[model samples]
Target: MAQEYGYRWGHSGLTADFDLDGDTPRLVRLARPGDHDLKGAVEAALPLVDVVLLGDGTGWSGPRFTGTALGPRLRHRAHHATYGDGWHHLTVELQDPASRLAVFVEYSSPDGVPVLRSRVRLRNDGAAPVTVRSVSSLLLGALPSPDVLDVHRARNDWLAECRWYAEDVRESVPDLGREFHGHDGRAGLRLAGRGSWPTDGHLAMGAFTDRTDGRCWAWQIESASSWLWEAGEADHHTYLSLGGPTADDHQWRHVLGPGEEFASEFAALALGDGFDGALAALTSYRRLIRRPHPDHEHLPVVFNDYMNTLMGDPTTRKLLPLIDAAAKAGAEYFCVDAGWYDDEGGEEDGSGAGGWWDSVGGWLPSARRFPGGLRAVLDRVRERGMVPGLWLEPEVVGVRSPVAAELPDAAFLRHEGGTRVTEQGRHQLDLTHPAARAHLDATVDRLVGELGVGYLKLDYNITTSAPGHLAHSRAWLAWLSSVLDRHPGLVLENCASGGLRMDGASLAVTQLQSTSDQQDPLRYPPIAAAAPTAVPPEQGAVWAYPQPDFTDAEIAFTLGSALLGRVHLSGHLDRMTLSQLGLVQEAVAVYKSLRGDLRTSVPFWPLGLPGWTDEWVALGLRAPVAGATYLTVWRRGGGVAELLLPVPHLAGLGDVRVEVLHPSTAAPGAGRAEWRGEGVRVRLGEAPAVLLVRITAGG
Candidate 1:
């Protein structure tokens, strides 16, 4: 397949080619196509090099692959976006610093498609970018029906469907929550089957546009999301910078230079089983490549379920004191949890469906509860100096909502077979449907623009629980990304029934997530321990202090949440012992000091293993500025008789001083050093923790 402007397309499963500007780069296959890997592509689409590959093809969603025509040295990673034009979208500019460029992909479903997903950037920063060379192919599997080939829009009873796509939105509010919000369209592309991939059976297309930019480039192939790579060892590796989209997926960015032109050749792999099957498949694909993108690192952010609390004068006043007490103790923001505005009002009043799809339009302050409206309460909290926030389940809606009765053809996902109640009171919001987005966009515009809300936490409490729903990973993740694009400054937390949605893709957008609903301090131990062990700490931001069990040990362990993400306070605030308060304050101070260093650096290990049995766990901070680490070894079953401290990264054994801090008893401990040319061996025992105190070279 050849399009004008040196873009030619080809796909034969395992390998494919894109003859862009005369140079042809082959895109090889990485693994066999599967449901999981393709789901991840729809979910995250993060850019990364294929340094690592999952051994068993079971976990990855599609047959993953990376393009190495440019090589890591040349840096050719990039993202693309097609407009409401369906599969084909245009790229806009976000940031173009020096040799690095940021492209914005935009789309809107004013037309008839169900879900719209697009990519967004390509950076060129080097001495000079050379001739751009790339190949586009998808890892695929045969899905042989023309009917199945054309994926349309459908809705379950829970909500209506809408046509929406990613874009470089140009909407602005004179005063965000008080003025207005909207999106600016860029370019769109129509869908035309270009070809099929080699290794796995899939389809493909090229990007050709007639916009003002006058840039028309031809590209090839859309295979199954699973078979992204095949054969050519170096060319097709799973790597690229991910700019937009949402959820736990990979997105990458690249810097091309003099002689290096920005080029992105992609293979589109299509699979259908809806979101759940997609997610299960995505889970595996994410497990394959562990590269870190820009958004993946942070200061351990978290979610506080306070935003949906008081939307009026009465409840706002009640929450003021609680908000003040919590914010001051090292908390970031407190999202008001459910029950604002006629939240639970009634079917006739938009209250009966208070959970997922309930809409509190007008920020309706329950006349019975707050009479003064939500604005007044927000003002009081601001006066007290804390960031105020709220929650909204944009995907679900209730049957009797005043707005529901007046909308256009709304899309919805209904209860599956074997179900008795067709009217579960609420319906899911079909973000993929055009009509649905118009309603949701307007709804959020009013709540956010009219109301002075700063943080918005969107929770999708049900994933696996519902079947036969429009529950694919791309649909929801796309919705989440669109929300973020609309409100870039707001912090969104992921709440899928108390951390049920803690995965790679969701973790991408929900910078912070609620680990569990059970705020009981007792339950925090086993659950919390597995988090740091199961996944990297960056995604697990914010573990709240589940009340009533606020003991000194709890405070120390509560700090454990720090290892996962941010520390959240969920206990009954009014009932705290003075000692408990003091202890929490101390832990916060200690956590604050270590956070900066923790967020940006990689986890270094002398033991190389984590969360296993040890006198303690040792970690090394590789950052030059904050170049030190803290190892915490809890007193184990035999009682930490000794600690085996290792300084494998240190240059010399003789120049460091190890400070011993004992727990329970101060019998004192010793620091012994051994000389090793490349590194050092430092040992300590009896001390709860041996703070590796390195002395200055001059001193």
Candidate 2:
């Protein structure tokens, strides 16, 4: 399709229309190929690059934004691209003649994925310096109006991460009635995250859908630092913009010297028929962008002695039995959680009273805790046919740690006024500094090479606020890549006090992500079900802690939470009875049988994106090639024993067959499933129970 005023390029599974006829080359449409042309639906004109210079302000009369003024004045210079390795890259050049400030909009996408990744680069071409306040990685118009569109967002926090909610666009940005007012509304809904914990306040993702038509657009800002996104009415239609840390939202600013360039963090967008479709597309894109690792494909079971089991107080005597039990349960990796380096015998056993909280940083095993050296425990792990793993929070040095004093002050992230920044009794390490990077490299090399450790649970516990967080974040990502390059086989788990740094930039380089530190088995369903929205199922490590005291239903409930994703098994299996251990073994056996499908399957929520306190929740994984569908349903204390869970995608198959994989029918209150019209009705006699069922078509 050719545009009369500009050009329309539809290739490699995506469509992008540019209005080159104007002084500024605007992205008129970004959607699926052969889809409806948005040229007629575009109610407002928006520049492809939303940038704010030092002097130039908003062109509109309402909220300050990077939509107009300097953006609209940028003249199109050239456009080019490259292609290889199942990926396509395109770059559009735009420059401001007055200030000699040049902007480059870069876009990339996988061969067949319905998602586009975008970013912006700014350069100073003039002799004078150019100060930039804000720049958007992606900006687009022609979205559905508030009257017919609904927006979905997630509020993230420790233990309660990935809590999704929906609201009408009018709820956030009131219906200004642009037609009657004779102008677009300036006010919009702005969502942002500050500090090093990128997802501490809210997720760097959002989606909007047409209620009647089910058309949806979902997006994620792939930044490990501060980010901001906004949506509002523009020219009768809504527009959405994504960006990294901005001057107004995060106290970030940069003065680009002559011939200097700066790149914004990447953002991705996916279009689909509904929320599930968009999320499934996003899942595929996530898999394509992440670093390739055997762990993602094998989907190994990790037994970490944290959460409700060890609680970060690892010792040889405490871990040996657990290691044996985990090996018997079919866990491929055994991880010794925190407190491994606590030389001081703090008063508390599993509590923070044990210098474990404030006196960290020396990645060494404590002789006092591990009587025969940590090597003995590690050797036992290997002897039991499991890889040894250790936990390390490499980004921070405790105030009481000697490493803090050994490294120079410049190695730590400092405030704008040159003061060392501290949070939660730890000083943040600035990976941009050579000394800090060296220290981390040494720590990891010793853990992997010297101690024969195969896996490392890299954690970031503190949230430090400082200027230039975006730059620091990029440096951190580079360092992570370097480590993986040197130790190609070593596995790294990206954890930030449990899912705080759950962003694409971080997930792209790490093998696994801790979905949450939520301890309660009952409260973990929503997090586990929604984690695929931010991460691929293979990379989202969901904890399944089944204790000896738990009943058969309780055990099934905990283990079922992680059946569809990467299983991070915890709990004191060492003390469980034969029957209890059998239950745990049964769950692991089922997981291993179907783990291969996780790498290729896309996620769907039959119960709709779960609510925090919803009584019932359902997550479906459908493998397109295998012609198989697996569903995990959790019933959290509701009287409803039967649920008619919708599975429209699988309903097309004429004959559907169901099988209960876990807690076989012989078990008390075993759940069963049967296909019905457009869905399957699952039944569990108990209120607090879980069921894992597999359905096949044309049986």
Candidate 3:
């Protein structure tokens, strides 16, 4: 709203005029409400189809539900409105003239954040059931710019995630060249994801920036299942269409009985001056939509013994000293990672038969690993003023575990032939079944009530590729909600082979997200620095694993990786010398001091989006409080000694004060910083070093 574009809405339809960084306003129209003038207006305005509902029928664009097809004729029924501080909500109902199908489109936008979100709900009103094949959550139509546009999207996998790229839209789809000449054929780029894991192949997000003007628009889908988004040029206009599962993508066909309704996942659209502006708006939107939790306000530091520490093999002797060291370093929650429940072997044994994945279920403490019982270790953690936590893969039953035979077949997910689906020596559990739900409930209750455990690191290591997996995810979330309702004090950490399952549906219920499982310190800066692009800064947990062998500068670099996000401490703390341990303590102290400001801050990249092997990566969290901004800068490999960081928000301010909040003394020859124009220039003496700088306005 700050950059006015002549946007307006009414009962008939909504229309907006894009500025395009010029005085003239280019008109763009949304779908009209009623059918009275729909045919005429749709032809004149070239409106993009917002909601695509597929059925066994034909339409103007060929097959009713296939690629870029217009399925049905919808007429607007009614409209409603609601407004609140920094937000507005609008809902419009549309009904098909021939069928009993009706679609309700809901749109909400916050004044503070430049984002517009939309979701669609399909209902059956006729006496017979309706087989609904597809529904889109969002669609936007815009007149094509005079110049070409570049499309941007991110690719995600297990270890290498959040990698982004941009290219000419025409290059990807050659048909776009024809659109420029007078050929109006349907042509554009389609990006989508299928099956249980929402972000397995391609992330459910996209963005486009005009080559002529700097204006940009980005969209993200918040769904736990299959989804798709298309950017196409047709009739001389470029449009963006996105939505949840479709029959073609996921074999998803739902039967809606009379009076039954189904709602699609939420999709959001953000408009800004450039990629950074769009990213900033998206960051604010994620915060606004997330469920409120007390843990967000507390911002406690968590120490997990998984990366570069115990490495998924924990025992009583190994944990006791590490627990005390973590407490001394100011860790509030001490999570004992995997291998805590292995009874087949003792520590130092590496037989594949005794691996953690093959012996998962039953959730019992290994007597061999904990000779004095797991409770003793947890009690020690509590005595040290830290909460006790455990690692759990609740969604899977090890193929070799006794629980696999104990639970009925109904408790496990099955394939088309009634055969149980197994992945990586594990069978997926169907939480919708009462037996499965009860088993998990008892496991959690016993751990919390008897062992005095206060936190759970819920991890998922398998992907459900068969049909009907969505039911299991929904049931899992429901079970989590019920547990939270019963025991509000228990905190949950969500992880999936380290961030494979990081999505809106799961993040809404869990307290924190483990950003990645990358182990090497040098290769982790990009993932840590770019985490805010997807997850909220306060909820993103980045590992700061400072070990004993690391140099002073290396320790600072590892610790600074988590300065802008939640500090997840790890590494061989018990092996560190007193001097090295003191440095770790100092970093924790600095993080605790800035935790409060992190909750209300918006993230910005002073240096453009970081590449995987960038020598220098910087992330800034600008707090709403005037003259306050927290910066985390990392110097990796070889680069220039001096770097200039732009602060657009504080550009006009005459003078500013900048100071290092961590690493009390810079490495020898690391030059001081000074305000230069609209940015700050700083010099660091060596690679593999870090600095946490705080910038404030000066009188």
Which prediction has the highest lDDT against the true structure?
2
Residue 244 in model 2: lDDT: 89
The parts of candidate 2 lying over 4 Å away from their true place are 179-181, 346-353
The candidates, ranked best first by TM-score, are 2, 3, 1
Total backbone collisions for each predicted model? 147, 0, 0
lDDT of candidate 2 over 1-699, digit per residue (tens): 467536766465687777876766777777786566544554365788888888887787556565657888889998887878988888899999988999999998888778989999999999999888889999887766677889999999999999889999888777776668877667788999887899997889999998978988999999999999988877767788998888887888899999999999899999888999998889899989888988887888999999898887777767889999999999999999888888776222433326667778877788778778889999999999999999989888888999989999999889978889888788888988999999999999898998999999998888866975677788999998999899998999999989999998999999999999999998999999999988989899999999999988899889999999999999999999989999989999999999988898899999898999998888999988547898988889866478888888776778778888976778977888888868888888777888888888873
Clash pairs, model 3 backbone: none
In the range 1-699, model 1's lDDT, one tens digit per residue, is 344222322222111112222112112112222312222221112222222211212112332233221212223233243333222343323333333433233321112212122232244444554222222222211112111121221110111111111111111101122113232111111232111111111112212112222211112221111112221111111222111111112122232454343323332221113322222222222222233333344352232544222222225446556666565565555666666655444232223324424343233445543456667666665666655677666665556565555544335443445331123455554455677667777766676677767666665533322322213234566666776677765566666455444433455445554555544333343334333322334544445453546444444444444442356554445456665655555555555555665554333344433333343444343334335544433332332344444544455544544332211122234334433444435554432323332222112
List the candidate 3 regions with Cα displacement exceeding 4 Å.
Answer: 1-72, 84-87, 143-147, 175-183, 347-353, 625-627, 666-671
Sort by lDDT, best first: what order?
Answer: 2, 3, 1
TM-score, each model?
A: 0.50, 0.97, 0.90
The 0-to-1 C-alpha lDDT of every candidate, in the order given, reads 0.37, 0.86, 0.76
Cα-based lDDT at residue 596, candidate 2? 89
The candidate maximizing TM-score is: 2
Per-residue error for 541 in candidate 1, Å, reads 2.0
Those runs of model 1 whose alpha carbons end farther than 4 Å from true positions after fitting are 1-314, 342-365, 414-425, 464-479, 503-505, 518-539, 546-549, 604-626, 632-699
Show the lowest summed lDDT stretch of 10 residues, model 2: 345-354
lDDT of 3 by residue, 1-699 (tens): 322333444221222322222221122443222212212222223322344445444333532232233323555566567777657777766666666677787778776456778888888887888776777777665534313778888877777667777888877555546535655444467787775667776667888887766666778888766778876654445667778777766777677889998887788887676787777778778877776678989989999998988887788888889999999999999999888898776553433125667768999998878888889999999999999999998989999999999999889999878889898899989888999999999999999988888899998877876666766777888899898887788889888877676777777788898788888888888888877877888999899999999987788889989988989999999999998999899999999988998888878888877888789888888887584887778888775488888988888787688888777664553435677878878777678777788888965
